[model samples]
Target chain A: MRAALYQAAGDVTVGDVPDAALAEPTDAVVRVLRSCICGSDLWSYRGVINRPAGSRLGHEFIGVVEEIGAAVTTLRAGDLVVAPFQWSDNTCPACRDGVQTRCDNGGTFGAPGTDGGQGEAVRVPQADGTLVVVPGGPDGVDEKLYPALLALSDVAGTGLHGAVLAGVAEGATVAVIGDGAVGLCAVLGARQVLGAERVVLMSRHDDRAALGRAFGATDVVAERGEAGIEAVRELTGGRGVRHVVEAVGTPEAWDMALGMARVGGTIGAVGVPHTTPQLGLFPPFRQHLTISLGVAPVRRYLPDLIDRVLAGSLDPGPVFDLELPLEQVADGYAAMSERRSIKTMLAG
Target chain B: MRAALYQAAGDVTVGDVPDAALAEPTDAVVRVLRSCICGSDLWSYRGVINRPAGSRLGHEFIGVVEEIGAAVTTLRAGDLVVAPFQWSDNTCPACRDGVQTRCDNGGTFGAPGTDGGQGEAVRVPQADGTLVVVPGGPDGVDEKLYPALLALSDVAGTGLHGAVLAGVAEGATVAVIGDGAVGLCAVLGARQVLGAERVVLMSRHDDRAALGRAFGATDVVAERGEAGIEAVRELTGGRGVRHVVEAVGTPEAWDMALGMARVGGTIGAVGVPHTTPQLGLFPPFRQHLTISLGVAPVRRYLPDLIDRVLAGSLDPGPVFDLELPLEQVADGYAAMSERRSIKTMLAG
Candidate 1:
């Protein structure tokens, strides 16, 4: 089977690799139908996160089940599904509480030693919780929306979870601090599920700026850092956003998220917070900011999002401006890395 | 009128002073019935909070409304009440949100012009929100609980709020990071309101230990730093306490609060967080902590607490082990300063 294998800088080769088998009784093998690039993928591309040679390189996908292990009872041969970025047993206390990303035995797809979802086929662990049965009973699944549904694997779920963590309540004014695909989706989430009165998107690129606005961003700020904060504050009547979704996983974004919250408001962070908060008061107590960080536990968010998309009220597909064939995987990476597209859809 | 004024280090003295008059329509002249020494009061005694010469010293008190301004409607002459350390308008959105400490207006107490509740004939501002009407119809009040009610002005409310902020669930094990009267009262709050299964009090002084146990602390850890953390983790099945009330206002106490919380638990901080949190990854991403800080908006927690006291369901007075005449406040401060008393109640 051919897969997107990380070889070197500016080097990814789509070629034959050893086919994956059900390595665990709880696993299910899926034939990849659509995969997508995520913001976190750029971490290794920029060498901020080192990738060992020949590492499997994707975590976002929607595909058809090709095989099922003995213990996998829910999913069977030729079943279509959308898999979340992280795999969980669906039985841990945290997973049961809808925070599967913090599952006691949580595991992520892609990266070294993990099966990458962006390939001819991939293996899923704990198939019951990792894969959600697609609407239309699999056969009615729309290919155009496949990129958007596959996005639920990580970016979209993370964006929506960011909204949830930020406490984006009905009529809340939300500012998403990052204009990546996830950030734009956070705007959609702030508006769609949380019923935010206003969604503000902080952006540096025109490509994301358009999608951010389309995804319910009532305001867009092109500036970064303090200027961006000021823009959000101005948009929010100088009190700052009532809720802020921190989608960018950087110190500056973290600080901006803190600044863009109203006093006593919350900053629901789903940016894969790598930087640990300090031991003392990280920000002065006045930000009255409550930061709910870590991965969004996309499994907790997938079910509701699928319902929204199937209902035809939301169209997250607007984020995928540059779709490409799975064979053109390198172009998709370069496009996202260069900010030419908010995301790229990989169709097999 | 005379008042105990904080002059300089070792310079606090009871002296004659100009009469305090109504400064605002919302203000009232309170003939203080009782006052007390607080752990925060020691900051000035230790030359920490450089208070200006002759500034009214005390912040904790229960008092009688001797004179109410025309605009003060809820409180009247002869009405006995507990004055919270901070003044809030009660009508602001922030106050309505149950965080009166961060009230849109009517801010901090005991700063320069801010009237201290400690002295005789002190001015009380924002009476509607700052004062909790003492029950018993303000007639034949239970003088025995006056000290405990006075402590509620700051200490007890602070501890309760700390526990509440730390997100202590009913029936969970609770660990308090300080052993002052506030920390002890937090044990009461946790046990009575939150139904804590275990109340662990961290105390270094024997005088505080006995009082802590009397106030429902099921266990006491005499150690202070890293070893103290180990003790708490050990007691909590090596996972850390389910909830931690940080009642000590120092970096050490703050660190202990972070160290003592289980992953995904809360740390309710009402201990005057003058410093930033520094626990890094634990606070931000890994520990999955929810940190709520601020002066306890006792106004929000008061009605229920006042009821508990009146109904004899809770006796917070056990925390005050010594009583001193107003003239001997110096000795009260000295007694607490020397660890000779758990807490000192001063008559007005």
Candidate 2:
């Protein structure tokens, strides 16, 4: 099988790898149908974060079950399914508590020995606990829905997780601090799904801002840093918003999220903190603020999000501004790394 | 009139000051019946935080309403009331949202021009909003209940706020990281008021630990730092508690609180962070944690706590291990500063 592999700084390639096969009774072989590059992948691509040479990359995918182990009960061969960024044994206390990302036996795909999602196939551990089957199998679903369904594997679910952490509710005023795919999704979820009365998207790019508006952002601010926070506060009558979705993990983005929250407000952060270290406690503490953050438990949200997508109420596929064939996975990475694409999709 | 004054570092004195009188249409004059030394008062006494020489000192008090301004309608002369550490209008958006500490027009009792709670009489601003009256008048309440009533002014309410921030709920497990008056109260509130199933108290002092046990701490770990975190983890089956109450403001205490929380847990901090600078975000972010912190909105919690106290379900008064007449206010400060007393009470 061919899979995306990290070679070194500024280098990624498609190369032949061992075929994914069921290694345990709890495992299932998935023939990936769609996969995509995540913003976090850029960390290793730019050498900002170290990755072992020749390691598999990517953690989002929608696929068909090629083979199921003897113990697999909930899924069968030929079933269409989405794999969350991380695999978890759903019976663990953490998974039962709705935080599958921290499940006792959970591990993310693309780690050293794990099968990467950006590949021809993946051997999924904890099969019954890790995969969510689509209502209709591969043949019943429209091919056009592939991008959105693949999104449920990571980005869309992550965005909704940010809104949930921020405690967005009916009539809430929210400020989304980034304009990436995840940020746009946060804006969409905070307004459309979470019922936020007002959502301000802090985006300097005209293209992303337009999409944000269509996705339910009530206002858009093109400013960054202090000016961006000021713009958000101005929109909320100088009190700032009650909920802030911090989709960018940079220190400046964290600061902006902090400054945009009113006293007694919350900041839900989802961005992987590659450059950021500490979130200064004093500022938020002084204002009685709440900060909820982490990688999204995408699996916990898959069913509902999948239903919403199939019902035609959600359309996050447009976030994938650039798509490439599996053989050109390198080009997809280059497009996202060079800022030429908001997100990249690879047809498997 | 006489009031406690901050003369300099390590110095506090009871001295003659201006008489308390109604200064605004919304103000009321309170004849203080009970006042107590708080852990926060030591910050200025030790010069950890700067305060103006000769400034009023103290923020918690229970008293009789001596006089009321023309616009004061909810309170009357001779009514018994307790004042939260900070004065708030209680009608502002922040106050309405149950975070009175951030009330738009609020100010602490010991601010330069404000009357200190450790005085014979206090000129309280925002009378209707700042004072919660005892059901019975000053004469109707027993003198034996004075200490408990005074606790409601700050310590008990602040402790409850910590549990609330940590999201203490039925059958939840909690860990309290301090054993001061506030920490002990948190133990009580988590188990008695908020219904936590089990509570672990991290305390090095035997006296405070005993009180913590009496306040419903299911277990006590006298260990500090890493050892303490280990002890807590062992008790919770290798997973830390889901809720942690950080009642001490030092960096070390904050770190311990962080270490004692399991993945997806919450840390509710009510300590005045005089020595701590920033809370490292990476650790919590990686664990998908939630941190809620600030100076507690004591006023918002006073009524319920008062009801609990009056019903004999709560008794945090024993946290005051030392008592002195108003003339010996300096002695009370020394006892608390020297660690010879858990807390001190001054009889007015």
Among these predicted structures, which one has the highest lDDT?
2
DockQ of 1: 0.51
Q: Candidate 1 falls in which docking quality class?
A: medium
The residue-level lDDT of candidate 1 at A242 comes to 67
**Residue-level lDDT for A67 in candidate 2:** 100
Tens digit of per-residue lDDT, candidate 1, span A107-131:
8888567788778888888887788
For model 2, residues B1-348, the per-residue Cα lDDT tens digits are 999999998989989999998889999999999999999998889888899999999999999999999999999899999899999999999999999999998999989899998989999999999999998887778888889989989999889899999999999899998998999999988998999999999988999999999989999999999999999999999989899999997899988988989989999999877765577677898888999999999999888888887788888888889989988988988889888999999997
Q: Candidate 2's chain A scores what TM-score?
A: 0.98
| Local accuracy of candidate 1 as per-residue lDDT tens digits, B1-348 | 767878787666788877878888988888888888788888888887677787877777787888888898898788888888788888887788787877878665566786665577678788777788887645767788786677777777878887877777777888998887888889888888778888999998887788788778899999878899999999987878768888876788877877877766777776766545454643546666666666677878778877777777877887788887788888888888888887888886
Give the DockQ (C-alpha) for candidate 2: 0.76
Question: lDDT per model, in order?
Answer: 0.79, 0.91
What is the RMSD of candidate 1? Answer: 2.4
